[model samples]
Target: MTNDAVLHTEGLTRRFGGLVANNNIAIQIHRGQLHAVLGPNGAGKSTMINLLSGDLRPSTGHIFFDGQDISGFSADRRSRMGIGRSYQKTNIFPTFTVFENCRLAAQSREPHPARIFSNALSYRTVCEAAERAIELAGLAHRAQRHANTLSHGEQRQLEVAMVLATSPNVLLLDEPLAGMGAEESARMVELLQRITPDHGILLVEHDMDAVFAVAKVVTVMVNGEVLESGSPEQIRGSAQVQVAYLGAEDEHHG
Candidate 1:
């Protein structure tokens, strides 16, 4: 495990009865880099993210966060410990203004449960965090707009803002570009490029173009095991990756 890694998994394995979800895998996500995990269906990408976020415990192996062993921690605990995640589905309060949703997420990180019921606008610290997060996600102009009123792409950015509100050191983003069009995808790619310079990002995405554009390293998985890992150029040219994941598209064009 690398000492500089904010999130590291060692020999991580998980099983359900007789079925293995994640095999013996060791991966590192260093600070200030975006590491992307790409694989076909049933390749254990979701399982790996679940394990890292502490949603599911590893049947075998260990998870570390910020140099601390946190395999035993729960999902909420991991979030508080600077490990945050965004789901494929939009996760924001539909009725609330964009700022309000981000404010709530930021308030949750303060360790004061009573504040949950308090008027959110009263907290200066939380407001500042929300502003910073919204700005980071490129939604600062829409902060006052109701979440439901925004387009799907803006909603997705709001979800990312919510994750940022928690001030996490590592971000696990699952298919953030899942439903985006070309323009939205381009915006998201830009947002990722800006944020990854300071935080470690573990992205699970099917958009090979965006992944190749923003990721510093790419890890390819096949049937719950790592098949190859290297720079974008290397992954783009790997025969194994082309067969297992990228298919014949690259070969046809190359």
Candidate 2:
């Protein structure tokens, strides 16, 4: 593993009965870089993130985070170790106000996340962290509104903010721009670019345009295997990539 790598996977594999969801995959994410995983549906992108986040144990192989072996850690444990994730689907408390949601997530980063009735409002540090998250996610104006009331894009942003509240050094973003208008997607790209200087982001997205625009390094996966990893320019020009993944439509758009 490279000293600069914050996350590393070695021969990672996951199997469900007869189905091999992930097959001997190896990945490395350098600290403070935006690494993108691109593939078609059912190419095991989500499965890969799940393994990295400790949501699922690998059938074989190991995972390391910040130079620590974390293959056996639980999801919660991984979160405490600076691994945070934003789901492809919006995962936020629907009834909770935006501020309340952020506060709750921020509180989870604390040693105690289940301290009910402890008056999180009185915890200046938690409150301040929540406020910063809200501002970063561009939800400060809607901080008082319920999470479900926000538009699809705003909800996605809130989910990201909620994850950020955990103060993670490495963030796993599963399709951060999944459901959004073009304008919303543009705004999300801008937001992601702004946050890159502060954290390492591993992104799983289908939007080739967005992937090409934001990612300094792109990993192309096909049929549960990584076909190539390179800079956007190299990927765009590679004959193997064009034959294996980037079809004619992708070239036309480019």
Candidate 3:
């Protein structure tokens, strides 16, 4: 177990009857670094996230988070234990203000989340976490606006803000740049850059440009197995990655 790594997995495997979604996967994520996972559809990217987030239990493997073995933990337990994630589909309270949404997320991690009778602001810790998350996610200026009023990009940022409010050490972001314009993509990338110093960001994205721009390490998967994992430059020049993934795209375009 490396003290520096916030998250690590050994032989992380998940099987569904005859199908093996994730196979003997070993990976490590250290804080202050962004790790990107790239793969085509059916390459087990989603399974990896599910396993790490405790949304799906591994069939055969071990998961360690911050030096604790948490493979048996549940999704909510993992969230409370500082594993945060944003889904591919937008998940926000459309009618709520940005601050309210963040405050709700912050409250979820609190020991007194069920204290409904008390004033929400009285939970100073939750309030502070929410405010800090809003600032970090670049939604401070829009804190008072309803969530549905924000653009698609800002909504994406809000998703991250909500996760940050939980005070998570690991962030599993799935396709954050899925539906965004050039400016929005740039802003999200910048936000990721600013936040990398705090958490071990596990990004599963199809956007190669974004992956290369922000990722310190890259892992490529094929057919539910890792074909290669290395620095961004090495991944870019790898013949295996080219043939299994990038080259396929290039040839299709050609």
Candidate 4:
């Protein structure tokens, strides 16, 4: 593993009965880098993310986080260990104020639960963390508004803020730009770039433009295995990638 790697996997494989979903997938997420994973449907991209997030145990392999082998850790355990994840769906509480949603996320990191009689927001640390996260996500102005009132783009940003509240060093984001219009997609791309310097990000996205714009490295998968992994420039120039993924899209449009 690289010294700066915040998370890495070695020979990660997952099987479901007779089917192999992910095969010998070894990837690395280093600090201050954005690694984007691209694959056709059924390429096992989601499975790889699930395995890294501890949502599913790998059939064979190892996951290391911050230099510790945590393959056996549960999802909750991984979250507490500074691995934060955002789903493909928006997971915020609709009725809560934006601030409240982030505050609750920050509160989850409290080592000791506050007394039941005490107010949840009265915890200074949690409140401050929440405030910082909202600002980082560019939602400070909307902090007092209810979550349901925000646009779809803002809601997605809120979810990321909630994850940020957990103080994670690694962020696993699944298709954050899904369903966004051109403007929303641009903002989301900007947000991803802004946050990349501070976290090791593993982004699974279908938007080729956004991925190429923000990813420091790109890994392409096909038929449950990696076809190529390289910088955006290298990926764009690869004949293998074009034949397997990129050119297929072009041919379809043609």
Candidate 5:
């Protein structure tokens, strides 16, 4: 493992019965870089994330984080090791206030989350971390509002804040911009761009415009395989990428 690499996979494969969701995949995510995994539906994007986060076990291969093998670790263990993920769906507590949700996530990272109940309302560190996360997600104004009361875009931002509360080194964002209006998507893009300088982000998104705008490196996956990996400009111009994934729409947008 190199010092710069935050996450590395070697020959990663996952099979469900006779179907192969991911096949012989190998990739490297460097520290403080925004990387994108681009592919059409059924390209094994979600499956790969499941494997990396230990939500699903790989049939074969190894996963390394910070130079340590983590193939056998659980998702919670991974999070504790500074690997955080935001789901495609909003995963915040609907009944909890935005600040409460963030506080819970931050507390989970502490040595004793149960103790948080004693003085959660007044705990300085927890309150401060929650405040920072809410602010980072642009939800500081809604801190006292119930999570379910927020707009869909705000809900998504809350989910990102929940992940941020964990103080992760690598953030695995699964479709952060999905289901948003143009304005909301633009806001998310701006927020994401601001955060990328501080965290290593691996984004899986269908929005070509957002992907190209934020990614320093883009890896194209097709039919459960990585077809090519390159800079955004290289990916835009690659004939293989065009044929396998980009197609005419991607070209026109590029």
Candidate 6:
């Protein structure tokens, strides 16, 4: 693993009974870069994400965060250590305003034990973090809107903002563009581009066009193993990658 990598895996593997979900996978996520994982269904993309996020312990191998071994850490522990994750499904408070939703996410980091009954607005640090996250996610204009009232794309943006509110340096995003129209996808693409300068992002996405557009590095997995790992151009040019995955996408688009 590179010494400078914010997050890197060393021979990461996960097994369930006789089935191996992920196998001897080693990947790196560097600061200020977008590393995307691509593959067909059941290729272990989600399993890898879960393992990195600490939702599932690796059956073998190690996960390093900022050069420290974090293979034994729990999901919440990892989050507090500057690793934030966004799920495929929208996880937000529909009844809360965008700011309120973000604020709640921020509050998770510093739940004032001394002021358990205090008004949430009284927490300056939490509020500021929430505001910063909303801005970073490009949802400042919608800060006052109710979450349920936002469009599908905006909801996705809100989910990202919620993760940002935790003030993480590394982000694990799972299928962030799963449901969206062309315009909404474009907006999300722009948002991702804007944020890539600061955080190390590990994205699991099926939208090949969007993945190729923003990712600085791409890792293709097949049958729970890495088929290729390289730049977008290299991935596009790889006959192995085309045969395993991109060929099917090309056929669908062609």
What tens digits encode model 3's per-residue C-alpha lDDT throughout 139-162? 899999999999988898888789
lDDT of 6 by residue, 83-193 (tens): 999988888999999999999999989987687678879889999999998987778999999999999888888888899899889999999888776876787789788
lDDT of 4 by residue, 1-254 (tens): 45457899989999999889999998989999999999998999989989999999999999999889999999999999899998878989999999999998998899456488888877999999999999877789999999999999889888888998998889999887887768767877887898899999999999998999999999999987989999999999999999999999989889
TM-score of 3: 0.92
Clash pairs (backbone) in predicted model 4: none
Best by lDDT: 6
Q: Score each candidate by Cα lDDT.
A: 0.89, 0.88, 0.90, 0.91, 0.88, 0.92
- Between which residue pairs do clashes occur in model 1? none
**Candidate 1's error at 254, in angstroms?**
11
Give the TM-score of each candidate.
0.91, 0.93, 0.92, 0.92, 0.93, 0.92
Expressed as tens digits, the lDDT of each residue in 1-254 for candidate 5 is 35547898989999999999999999888777899999988999999988988889999999999889899999989989999999887888999999999999988766464674576666678778889998987888999999999999889888889988888889899998887778878887888888888788889999989999999999999989999999999999999988877785656678
Q: Which ten residues in a row have the lowest lDDT in candidate 2?
A: 108-117
C-alpha RMSD in Å of predicted model 6 compared with the true structure: 1.8
List ranges where model 2 is wrong by over 4 Å. Answer: 111-117, 248-254
The runs of at least 3 residues in candidate 1 whose Cα sits more than 4 Å from the true structure, single-residue gaps closed, are: 114-118, 248-254
In model 5, residue pairs whose N, Cα or C atoms come closer than 3 Å (at least 3 residues apart or on different chains), thus clashing, are none
Better of 2 and 6 by TM-score: 2
Question: Which candidate, 3 or 5, would have the higher lDDT against the true structure?
Answer: 3
Model 4 — TM-score against the truth? 0.92
Off by over 4 Å in 4: 1-4
Model 6 stretches astray by more than 4 angstroms: none
User: How well does candidate 6 score on lDDT at residue 253?
Assistant: 87
Error of 6 at 3 (Å): 2.6
RMSD after Cα superposition, model 4: 1.9
Query: Residue 8 in candidate 3 has what lDDT?
Result: 91
Instruction: Return the candidate ranking by lDDT, descending.
Output: 6, 4, 3, 1, 5, 2
